[model samples]
Target: MDPAVTAAALDDEHRTFARLLREHQGIVATVAASYCRDPHDRADLAQEIAAQLWRAWPNYDPARRFSTWMYRIALNVAISAVRSAALRQRHAVPFDERLHDVADPAPRDPQAEQQIRALHAFIQAQAPLDRALLLLYLDDRSHREMAEILGLSETNIATKISRLRQRIRHEL
Candidate 1:
């Protein structure tokens, strides 16, 4: 690709990424909150995910669903952020009682908030891959979408979900 042409394409790709991110802000927020406990860390991870999404936009195929691509990038960035000990050590922040701001506007019940907090605590205890599966499950994604986002076969997604269900049931 010519230098000027490449720059133009990159700019166009970033514009597309920005529009998609706006359309799917909920997905970003969900992934960020599900992956991190600290509010500052969640914000940082969300920003990193957006930056990576923009950089990876040129590789995205227009025929594919943008949400699928965004989920993959967001989850990958989130997973990496959790794995990077140096990053965590350097940017560690205290998590206060106030939960990270979710976009919910409805008057939330105390019981519901407590339940959500409990669920997040349980999810935070799981392995990285398991956390990814639970996040997709919580999002009500179908097996095919989950498989696509996680790069697993549909059968694998089904089996893992079944196990997750069993575990959740046992916990409840």
Candidate 2:
């Protein structure tokens, strides 16, 4: 391939990837936000996930599902970020509790909001991989697809999802 053509092709791929990100921005942000207690940190994590997704785009396999691949990368990045932040906090001096303001939950339609808030709270309390698994399950992904995305056996996916649902119910 000519240098200019290769560059152009790469540019096009980036653009397409950007479009996909924009289309699914809410899903990505919600997943990232659920992992963090700080709003600023959530936004930063979402941006980092987007950047990682862009960097990984060149290696994306066309024969596979794009959303599945993207979810795996985004979830991995977000989970790693949360873990790193938690490690740092563990080593830091404790801050004054009075300095922190409680975050008011977002307003939503009463009936729908109740379920959403319950689910969000459940997700925040779970392990990072469990959170990702619940998110994929809520998104209606099939067991085989979830297995492929998480690099687990289909039977494992089914079992994990069942356990996660029980955990979520317990949290609520």
Candidate 3:
């Protein structure tokens, strides 16, 4: 309970949190990009995700997989951002197309680029929960893992994945 010992422990905790956050930083970026179209919004969402993760760090169980824990927090923050944006936009006027980000003029493979764009469009069109499911699926997460991250049953995850695949095939 000495002050020096307490400071050292706090420093160690901060270091551990930083290391874990760096190790799984991609989860934050991917979730942010998946939910936000604008670059600024994506950065904001990523920051929020990191902050929330740090805030929740003391409760993080070392026995649990860090990536799994990171995904849950990242996805939750992204979903909340999407919901908040939707709520704000509901009563707002539309913006001009000129303000949107412009696409690159030259795609290495036009066909592949088109497909990627179509897939992203499809993902963005989904409801928030479905979007999270698709992101986890695309990331090659197992049904059990997805269920753990999203707080759903493994059976429900499998069923939803099957339905999502059918929808993707039909629509995209």
User: Which is the leading candidate under lDDT?
Assistant: 3
Q: Summing lDDT over every window of 10 consecutive residues in candidate 3, give the lowest-scoring window.
A: 92-101
Candidate number of the best TM-score: 3
Which pairs clash in model 1?
Answer: none
lDDT of each: 0.79, 0.72, 0.79
Q: Please identify model 1 stretches exceeding 4 Å from their true place.
A: 1-12, 88-101, 108-111
* lDDT score of residue 139 within candidate 1: 76
When sorted by lDDT, best at the front, the candidate numbers are 3, 1, 2
What digit string (tens of lDDT, one per residue) describes model 3 on residues 1-172? 8999999999999999999898878678778777766666667878999999999999999999999999998988877776785634632211112222232344357787677668777887788899899889988999989999999999999999999999989998
lDDT of 1 at 75: 89
lDDT of 2 by residue, 1-172 (tens): 7999999997898789888888877567656655655656666777898889888888989898888888888888877876795733632212112121123345557787577556665665667778778878878999988888778999999999888877767776
- How many residue pairs clash (N, CA or C atoms closer than 3 angstroms) in each of the candidate models, in the order given? 0, 0, 0
